[model samples]
Target: MVSPISLDALQTLDAIDRRKSFAAAADELFRVPSAVSYTINKLEEDLGVELFDRTRRKAELTPIGRLVLEQGRQILKASEELTALVSQAKDGWEVELRICIDSVLTCEPVYDLIESFQRIQPKTEIRLSEEVLGGSWDALCDDRCDLVIGAEGVSPMPGFSIHSLGEVEFKFAVAVDHPLTELATPLPSSAIQDYPIVIVADSSQHSPARSMGLLDGRSRIVVPTIKHKIEAQCKGLGVGYLPYHRITDALEEGRLALLTLETPRPPEEISVAWRRGNSGKGLKWFVERLQQMTLDPKRGLQSADN
Candidate 1:
């Protein structure tokens, strides 16, 4: 009678503690505020203890409530790991496959692969997240994703199955009307510093943010994605590097003019990484197909598996 609590009630209690209010917790759990309150009340009724201080304006956890939360999170995590372990050992397919995609790569191509994969294995659900630089790796290392594609380098933390996707050539480019084009070819760093460089901010949460191609003491316009950086550069709002593959048509059509740097910037090396372990059929299906796919220069996207 006074022994164990349901995982559902524990989860509701944890959510209430995290969100700090019944209504807010309801919003997070996608349930009605009354439902959240009822769940908490039922949990307290079963546990034979008061979990919150209703006298205060804010929801303050009682001493016992704090104790429940501290242990509740552990139970939630262990439940997740066990579920994954069982899925791997007993069932070849996973319930879902979470992937972290780098922003520099286009989503259309990856979607193509997803479409193909679903034909053969329609049960596994796929969720995709876009991360920049170290954020992609962080997602995999933090167990947020089963696979990471277009990550900046070979797996930095080790124990990941790393494979080179290919190196992307970076070209110093600006709008046709940009003052940078008026400057002499092979722009020098001193001359370059006069203009603002557009950059994509790294979106790492579990790790420190990474900056790319930021000159010391130079002004920069930091944007959240590659598309924004492209738009800013196309309007002559800033000067910076764009992936050659991305700007090929723009360069040919005169929307962008490639500027030669006195010291050329190196191409960005990219790789696909996944954690070591049986990731189940969904993830394995992705890895095997991704390894065979390559960027098709003629079509301007990844082609069918080679």
Candidate 2:
């Protein structure tokens, strides 16, 4: 069905209502007074409603006219936003930015980055998702995410570029009262192989899955995220290396105890990665900001409970 209202008609109505006279509205809209009068007359005729009170020398909006003006102002604002979005698209700003963060790192810093980005590009949409182990790199390879943080291990192929975010230190930990804590210091894999080990299931779909700090022939308690692994290990449900930054509170509270291993898990290098040749403004904004900042999990807590 055809609507009686048009954008031009709404603009004329708004100008006349604000200026309080047809001649003044014409001056504001850069149109002749007769044109403004004709527009309001045609709109009232089409809608079959009197939009103005003619008894006064000044144009006074009727109750319905006031409502229409209020609603029309919102439509005008949305149209202006659409025009700005088109302009941004021409300038290489993406309509949306997708970020994939690995579970090994703290998300608080990422949240801070997003908050800062919103202040500059409020029109652009931002999306965030968690990936485990190789899933971060996989997200970029599959084009599921535009940027990946804490992407560890070797790149699956050679098309992605990466910048070091810093390294996450892993420590062997167990619940304070767990049987493994009773074992001698510098515990060897043979001493703890019988205990269940908590592992975060890799999120990779097309890429091969990866694991760390697991010994041969151990009972596995696979969880979906590093946060869960911490909880499981703190409860004595399993034993494994937890990111030193993520488990500091547990260690301080005596919920968990760290043990030395004959061969300790080395610090893993975490990086920010993006596909080569895809240089959207949003992607570059993140890459530049992340490279300049430190990703110390100890200083950046994931949550208050942590």
Candidate 3:
């Protein structure tokens, strides 16, 4: 038997529930308020359920109405996915592509690549978000993103493919006026232990959070991004190892000074990664382009195409 509910009515219900008024829903749906009201009224008549408590001044969903709205959103989401899947099947590209970028790397080069990609596939939407450390890999593993750039720490799991973007070297640095700056080269751990250390907090949600250059019993100042860590160190708030590429200006301007450490941080190997079995042209385009290049510490993504 055919159900009395229609997709259009469900959409109107959702719009009203979200927009909070018939007039607002009408504006969103590009229809007159009467049309929006009529749709809801007709749906109520067919279903024999009052979706809203009309006695209230503001449009509010009843308990049954809330249940319907909750279920209706899932239906709408599935419908959208089916439509996009059909479109993707026809063309080799996807309707949208989401990319997660590691916070250690600058986004300028990635933006340049995006500009190049849009020349061919302008209709496809590109979404970019920044993740720190293992968060990039976590985003891909959890299906939160289709592709990741500069993913580090975790090795390739069973579902995704990865290609090296090369290693980023780190340098032990402190503000020029910091107490550590006055110490001898190859500063002893005992001398450094008294000062505070700055660090970027890991952004991973599912995996264990990772940190670098942290010392036991040392005062720590934690910030959200590498840029912030750099700023904090420059202000004489703390001392830590920072990516050499990101601090050239600070060093040249005499804002921060590098120190030799007995135990230096090893260079980190970063990579471009994407979930396997994704046939979308956007992901393939980036994977191919990124695999040919290496992440230059001073120059960002380095290749002939760049």
Candidate 4:
């Protein structure tokens, strides 16, 4: 029969890997260097493998030891979380909840929800992730998030529960000093293609990526977030569409000019997406509050004018 791995041995391995030396790990753990070495040898003998390269000045993990260390880190994380889960079990609270927000959204709207959640379940840990475009949807689909807010409301994937947020308007905006400002009304696709467009790279992992407002042959510069895209456009580095609500003040102040395209883009109806089954009580409570969520009336336009 195979021997079962001990959690103490795993911790010792991690301490050694992290410290890069048995002497240092022993110091950190308040044990003698010999005791630490004994633990390592015992673990290796139990697993029937060499765990460290003693030939090196600093002990380095063997190939299989590196793999075990990686898996051990995951187990260590799960074990720590198990304590929190058990502590909250009597009250039906989640040990952790991950929320992914779209970069297009301002966090001000969710502050109240967070405050309320903390009041209701003080023990539940909350994490927030900011993603652009399909990244939010991909987070929920890939199990990285319990709920994703401001994902594209429409997607090809099935098995998700989508709750509408509101329609977000897109404006073809450029810096006031750009050549596009000199272009006559109704900028054609052909002329627009000559200028480079800045786009946010999708952070999706599993879902097939999607694109919006991009032309067939336009030169493109990709950025990580909506804020970065806006920054790129505002510096006259490139041109592209931005949310009208986000750029309204800039447009009115003449910092960014709205381009009247020959082909107008439609508003995106954004929403929250999460998987449908076995949601924890904490998740259920949050979803009820999100259902009553409202959009800002100052979102500017319902649709872009052609």
Best by lDDT: 2
State every prediction's TM-score relative to the real structure. Answer: 0.68, 0.81, 0.71, 0.67
lDDT of 4 by residue, 16-54 (tens): 999999999999999999999999899898889999998
- lDDT by residue (140-181, candidate 2, tens digit) is 888999999888877878998888767788898999999877
Instruction: Report lDDT (CA) for all predictions.
Output: 0.80, 0.86, 0.85, 0.81
TM-score of 2: 0.81
In model 2, the runs with Cα more than 4 Å from the true position are 1-4, 19-24, 47-70, 210-219, 294-306
Model 1 lDDT per residue over 39-98, tens place: 888878877999899999989999998898888889888898777667654778876789
Residue 189, candidate 4: alpha-carbon lDDT: 78
- Candidate 3 is scored at a TM of 0.71
Give the Cα error of residue 168 in candidate 4, in Å. 1.2
Off by over 4 Å in 4: 1-84, 297-306
TM-score of 1: 0.68
Q: Measured by TM-score, how close is model 4 to the native structure?
A: 0.67
User: Which pairs in model 2 have colliding backbones?
Assistant: none
Clashing pairs for model 4 are none
lDDT of 3: 0.85
